[model samples]
Target: MARILALDYGVKRTGIAVTDEMQIIASGLATVATKELLIYLEGYFKSENVELVLIGEPRQMDNTASESEVYIQEFLKKFSEKFPQMQMKRVDERFTSKMAFQSMIDSGMSKKKRKDKALVDEISATIILQSYLYK
Candidate 1:
């Protein structure tokens, strides 16, 4: 089966994750500059059979769109236009960042490594993919 891809989008950087061919496990793939996301995806798609792109959808405590939602929506529009053949979906991303941070602490990562924003983003993407899989 084709793999499922997930994204944790930010204005400057984006986190990426992918499920295995069997779609049973989700793993962190990479963290790329937002400007280069399309190029990265192009290269990835050329080698991997990806059936869907799951984007993290930010929301507030009230279940409404957060401020970052606008940026994500804009990115989604361009991504849809660029990869017209690929399917796309959104998964709620609430608390993923906090969970990622807690995960880092649980793993006993160094303070310096824990400060790595890219790592947090990557983990968040993985969490998003995992959530989708379990759902």
Candidate 2:
């Protein structure tokens, strides 16, 4: 089976995660600059067989779209245009960042290490993928 990838989109950076070839075991792949995200994915797709991509959908507590969704929507349009054949889906991403932070604490990560925003993004992407898999 082809791998399924996930992204936790941020303004400055984005987190990436992917499942194994068997479509199991979601794992953190990278934290990349948001401005360079498309180029990075293009390179990655050349080496990987990703069948579907899950883009985190930022939403508020009331289920309304988040303010940052305008940015995400713009990225989505660009992505769809760049890779028209590739499939993409948006999975709700509410609280994933907070969850990722708590996860760092649970895993006994150092305070200094937990302060790394990139690490948090990567972990958030992993959590988003894992949540989708379980659901």
Candidate 3:
């Protein structure tokens, strides 16, 4: 089976994660600059057989769209233009950043490491992919 890839997109950075070939386990792939995300993905896709790409959909407590939703939507448009052949979908990502931070705490990560915003984003992507696999 082909692997599944997920992204936790941000304005400054974007986190990436991918499932195993069997699609059983999700793991952090990398974090890249938001502006370079498509370029990075172009390279990764050349070497990997990704079945579908999952993008985190950030929403608010009231299920309303987040302030950054417009940016995400714009990115999505560019993503479609660049990878029209690639399958893609969106998964709810409410509280994923908080969840990722708590996960770092649970894992006993060093305070300094936990403070790494890029790492948090990567873990958030992993969580999104894992949640997709779970359901």
Candidate 4:
């Protein structure tokens, strides 16, 4: 099976994760600036045989869409237009950031390291991907 990709999209930075071609392991890939995402994705897709995309859906505790929904919808439109053959799934991302931070802290990461939003975002994306995979 081809690999699946997951994205934790943010206004400043976007986190990326990818599954193994066998669809078993999900690993953090990279964090890209929001403005550069489409261009970056174009290159990434050229090199990787991604069969699906899982986009993190930031939701409130009440299961309502967050303020970023507009931006995500715009991205979804572009994503669908570009990768019409690939399927896209939305996975709730409630508390994923907190979980990522906790994981980093539990790993004994330094304060400086913990301040790296890109790394945190990448890890969060991995968590989101893993959640989708096991569902």
Candidate 3 Cα deviation (angstroms), residue 119:
0.3
Q: Highest lDDT, which number?
A: 2
Q: After superposition, how far is residue 35 of candidate 1 from its true place, in Å?
A: 0.9
Each model's lDDT: 0.95, 0.97, 0.96, 0.93
lDDT of 3: 0.96
**Candidate 1 error regions (>4 Å):** none
Candidate 2 segments exceeding 4 Å error: none
Summarize candidate 4's per-residue lDDT along 1-135 as a digit string, tens digits. 898999999988999999999999999999999889989998988998988899999998888999998899999999889878878999998888999999999999999999999999999999999999898
Q: Model 3 over residues 92-135: C-alpha lDDT tens digits?
A: 99889999999999999999999999999999999999999999
Using TM-score as the measure, the top candidate is: 2
- In model 3, the clashing pairs are none
Q: Which residue pairs collide, candidate 4?
A: none
TM-score of each: 0.98, 0.99, 0.98, 0.97
Ten-residue stretch with the least lDDT total in model 2? 17-26
Model 4 bad stretches (over 4 Å): none
> Would you list the rank order by TM-score, best first?
2, 3, 1, 4
Candidate 4 global lDDT:
0.93
Model 4's C-alpha root-mean-square deviation from the true structure amounts to 0.8
**Per-residue lDDT for 60-132 in model 2, tens only?**
9999999999999999999999999999999999999999999999999999999999999999999999999
Model 1 poorest ten-residue lDDT run: 71-80
- Local error of candidate 4 at residue 42 (angstroms): 1.0
Q: Which ten residues in a row have the lowest lDDT in candidate 3?
A: 42-51
